[model samples]
Target chain A: MTTPLYKKTAREIRDAVRSGAVTATAVTEAHLARIAEVDPKVDAFTQIWTDEALAQAAAVDAKVKQGVDPGPMAGVPVGVKELICTRTGKTTCASKILENFRSPYDATIIKKLDAAGAIFLGKVNMDEFAMGSSTERSTLKTTKNPWNLKCVPGGSSGGSAAAISADECAMAIGSDTGGSIRQPAALCGCVGIKPTYGRVSRYGLVAFASSLDQIGPLTKNVEDAALSLNTLCGRDPLDATSADLPVPDFTKALTGDVKGLRVGLPKEYFTEALNAEMREKVEAAVDVFRRGGAEIVPVSLPHTDYAIATYYIICTAEASANLARFDGVRYGYRHPGAKTVEEMYVLSKSEAFGPEVRRRIMLGTYVLSSGYYDAYYLKAQKVRRLIKKDFDDAFEQCDFVMGPTSPIPSFEFGAKTENPLEMYLADIYTISVNLATLPGISIPCGLTASGLPAGLQMIGRPFGEETLLRAAHCYEQTSGITLGEPPIA
Target chain B: MSKITKQDVEYVAGLAQLRLDDAAKERLVREMGDILAYMDQLNELDTSNVEPMMHAMEMTNVFRQDVVEPSLPREEALMNAPVHDGEYFIVPRILEGDAS
Candidate 1:
């Protein structure tokens, strides 16, 4: 069966627009119509830029009329995560602190998407300051999983992934601090790629954890993820951490051949903690590679159990420092008529921050405090080094490591909310990738008995996105699991 | 690990410039203890000789030429300020209590 226009892949939209089979205006309108039809059920968007999107789409059509090459992603409608700054509207990061704040400049990735002729649909919701795993932490709105409206789209990129799954937008950009991108994509039955740290510029991505945050794409398929990465990767003088290495045309990496590719199965990831159904799906995904003439080797990342603890320390510490810039003096929310500066700072933060964000900030402050600094923050940093080394050692015996993207499939909203430790544990399988600074992708492997989708994750060497994309593309093609439209779709 | 006390939560909250009420403080004390106990597992790793991986990429002192580029207009920069006086953001008194 042919997919609906709203459900079409980004490449299909770009192809039709480029070949004059359809106008970019029509493509943009179809998506806007889809958003209007289904967004209330999914709650995937924080804002929908109908007028601005149509204007941008009209501009694309005008360029085509003038015989201008409108760029690789020409006429594709895309959503930018609310945390990624855009000049057009408020970038709230799903927190009340910046509810009315408008970015003065576009993020580096936003500029790149504009250059590529991608239409900015609008900002999507996320966990407040990208803190929680389940986007139940988003103060703005509750974004439900498109697959099962009662279940959560695993977050902090919950809205971004859900938008793609619900066909609200062809593709969306999401920043993964821990498993924000991959976790949500896995749960929502789509593709999400978190490129190696420094691979994509984080110039205007509102920092959650400066070290772990990398902006990437959540899309309908692996090919679209590769295409979006091609647009996003490059050096940026504005971001000192952006890599100086040359970016390869990521689309060129999708040869769909896994012959001679050595995939590693991390023994730590396939433990009893994983759900039985999800484990079976992941094993089936690996078998596809093995049957395609690729060798599967077993490897061990002994530090796997320590990943959650280490991640919480380092991520929270960095977040505390990064978010300190939000004091009332400069911009964002402020408490009116406070007697002293300290009181004003206290009141403003207390009112604007959600519970989880405040809890993390306090924890961060404690770890980085004078007496406990060495025991907590410094020790976690050293453990982070061990995590990175574990991946490095494993990579020597294999080209890429494979596992389940999340320990279990998507759970009901508020299932793990009361216990923060339990919520943090849900990120066990995905957090180590960020700690090691490696590129990782999550693709829908198969569906559970109840019809929920399960994702298989692939990890590659630092800056090894090309190899990662090649393997993902090959598996996505041969897996034969049809991309079923969600209930809302 | 010893359980974090309400006193510890209050001290950290003060340092972070956040004001938590009695209920928030009581809950945080218990939550914080559980989190810290879980985090103590890192002590099991023999990382005495390992160097901290601070930045993902091993680069330092990324310097650029000392040239000024056009910056955001003053109005645009203050656009999001809660209480701006058309030129600068207005905040509470810094030094004295009555200096408004």
Candidate 2:
């Protein structure tokens, strides 16, 4: 049987649309129909941009008819995470505070995707302010794993990953701070990349933690990720932190051969803490690299143990400072019937923010507040430097680091919600990559005996996405472990 | 490791501009204390010699030519405000009381 149009990769859809073999409207309609069919079960989307998407897809069809280039991502259906600002709809960040808020302008990546001929599939749900490890924290809706309805599609990009896994869209844009992108991608059996800090512009991305947050794509395969990166990456004057470096054609790095490459195996990542089956799957992936003409180098990141602590302190501190702009007087949901502005500020924020967000803000406030600042924030920053140095040393001995993305596969909802620290530990293996400001990708390594997908994470040096992509693409193509469609698809 | 008291949660909530009820304040004291205790593990490392890395990557002040550039117009800037008078944002009350 031929693959359904909804199941085709972004590249196939783009080529077909550009060649007029398929109308962009039909493609959009097919995916929109697919979304209508499945999203009720998955609850992945916060809002579906039906009218706007059809209108945009029609424009792509018109371009094809007029003999104009339909751009690189022609007719590709993309689900944007709610945190990304779009002029067409609300940028909710999965929180009630921004429930009614509409961005006056599109984010840099939004404009880039639109210009590249991609159709918006609307904003998907996320953990409030991208704070939680599961989408259960989302105020908008609960998103379930497409692989198993009971299990959580790992989050703060849960909706993004779930939509891709369930074939609701060709690709979903997600942000990673403490593995929001890579972790969810891993759990959902998709390819998710957290590019090197500043690899992509964060101008229109609502900040979770300014220093650690990054925008990336969650797609079915590495090629799609590389294509998305080609369009997404570039320095923007609007984001001062954007890297002023050339974004090499990432697709070129998909050199099917990983011969002579050095892959680092960190001893700390493989421990009693990691589920045995997950470790075996990761080891098998490493063996693939070894047999495929790549050398495995054992390395140590001693500061790995401190990654979670350091991340929490720094991220919360940054989040508190960044989210300070949401005063009641300005845009977004404000508390009405306030006798005074101070009361309004407090009531507006407290009333709208969910539990996890308030917890983070409280923790952030405590750490950044006067007396405790030097002990917590300063100490965490110093440890963060050590984490970076660990990666620096590891890269000297190897091209990149490889391990299981999450210590365990996707878990059932409410499993870790009771203990916040436990949920934070779900990102143990992926957090250090963010702390070091390196590029990381999570590809479907293999599945467990029960058929849950396990992700193999690859961590590379600063701006080393090309190498990460090459090795990932090599493993993804050569390894026989294909991620056949999730049952929901 | 230090213990987090109810007063600390209350005080921090105030600083964060969040109004928490008594039950939330009680719950947070215990939760935040547990979290802070775990975070105390960072002190085991001797970071005395390490210069704090405020950002993951090297940062520099980015400058553009001092010239006129397009920016958000007034109406668009106030577009999402909860309460607006078209020309200005309307707020409850600022500065105690200025007899209007």
Candidate 3:
């Protein structure tokens, strides 16, 4: 019997397709078979496009046989986050309100990937409207961590993390409102990048927080993340917010050398609040970077403690405004037999949205309301500016900052669900980057004593992804932490 | 410190247009209270002269071209709507004297 091919990276599969060792159709069938075998247990995909993916792969194979050159990512299996629009597939954002909705056009990022000849595996599950820190808020199905089924993979990109961890797809694209991408990737023992705000187009990503939203890549290694970002990052006419800077060759920058790079260790990040195991693992990873010809220095972000509260207020305010369009009249579920439009609008949202989403909406409306705008929303925005200044000052002395992605590794599924404050605190270390619009990447550093994975985050200046990718690739090469796979049930 | 009361929660919910049930209101009251208390940490930081920033970097006057561009077809734009009436979206009557 031929061996199944779920464990190969996108680059490896691309090589096989290029050398005629494995046809694109064969690679597509292999991933579909793997999904058929494991998706029921992992519950990663909200909608599986088996026939479409297969046909796309077959078309690539036919083109190759006819001596026509496909693009760089030809036949690579990629899972799109549920929030991204796909022309021929359903894009529900994992919410019951939009269960029947199908986008008539593809998102700009999706178009880029499609043009590169990447196979669309499916849309992965996420928190409803990308609000919560756990996938449990998804109205469709909870995506379980492939490593330990009882724990969450982290969210609102939980399904993307779970799919990459379970070998369901080679790479996935996720949107980070705060730590959505990095948190999930950390918990699931994969690599995820939250690119600089506006580095990638947000044209068709269902808006969560317009000002803070960014589309980035999640993969098994930093190199693949770099490769995916190479294809995904560029200015798009459809998205006015996209950056107009020159796109760098991310893959060529992965030289596995960080000689003389200044890596700063933030004192506020490793405070008394951090879990001991996570601290040890993150520190050890820093030691590896120090040994890799990088200079380590101590840095302080004075406004660090205010990041969580500030992020919640600003993100929720933006979310309340962004989500106001789902009024049952435009798109999403509607309540039947309502006597008035007001009642229908209220009933549809009341029934469609989950508790966390509703909570944020209420808080946002409260903050943005006439009476409290200066005290809450405006104050948060002011503090957000200071937070950016803190990073700006710190970067004057250091090239990049290193920290633990989450204070603790993946907790149990229901650990912080009851207390919304606890869930908000989980994003403390990762929120400041979004507020500052900086680039950050999370790579698996080391495993806890209990065998759970821990992630070390590297934050860089705006448009400094090349430096961050170089540093992460250097650590990854020297640390030799194998990308652990989930035990097949 | 932010003094949020049950009435405040209800008022905010009203502004958001969300009709929360009795159980949800009670739950939100307790949760929001804790959240607000934690937010008191901001009171400790001195921001007497700090300017509030709405965006991260300096980006202004980002207006697009005034030239006409192709837009989505009417049917494609309305494909995802739950209900629509020809040229406009259909909704339950919001006003007392409005005819459906």
Candidate whose lDDT is highest? 2
lDDT by residue (tens digit), candidate 3, A88-171: 788888887889889988999889998888999989999998988779899889899887888888999999999999999999
Task: Assess each model's interface with DockQ, reporting 2 decimals per model.
Answer: 0.84, 0.87, 0.73
Cα displacement (angstroms), candidate 2, residue A254, comes to 0.7
TM per candidate comes to 0.98, 0.98, 0.97
Candidate 3 ranges with C-alpha deviation above 4 Å = A1-4, B85-87, B94-100
**lDDT of each model, Cα atoms only?**
0.91, 0.92, 0.87
| Per-prediction fnat | 0.86, 0.90, 0.77
RMSD of every candidate to native, in Å, equals: 1.3, 1.2, 1.8
lDDT of 2 by residue, B1-100 (tens): 3388888888898899999999898889888999999999998999889999986667777898899989999999999999999999998867775677
* Model 3: CAPRI class: medium
1 or 3: which has the higher TM-score? Answer: 1
Candidate 2 interface RMSD after superposing interface residues: 0.8
Where does model 1 exceed 4 Å of error?
A1-3, B97-100
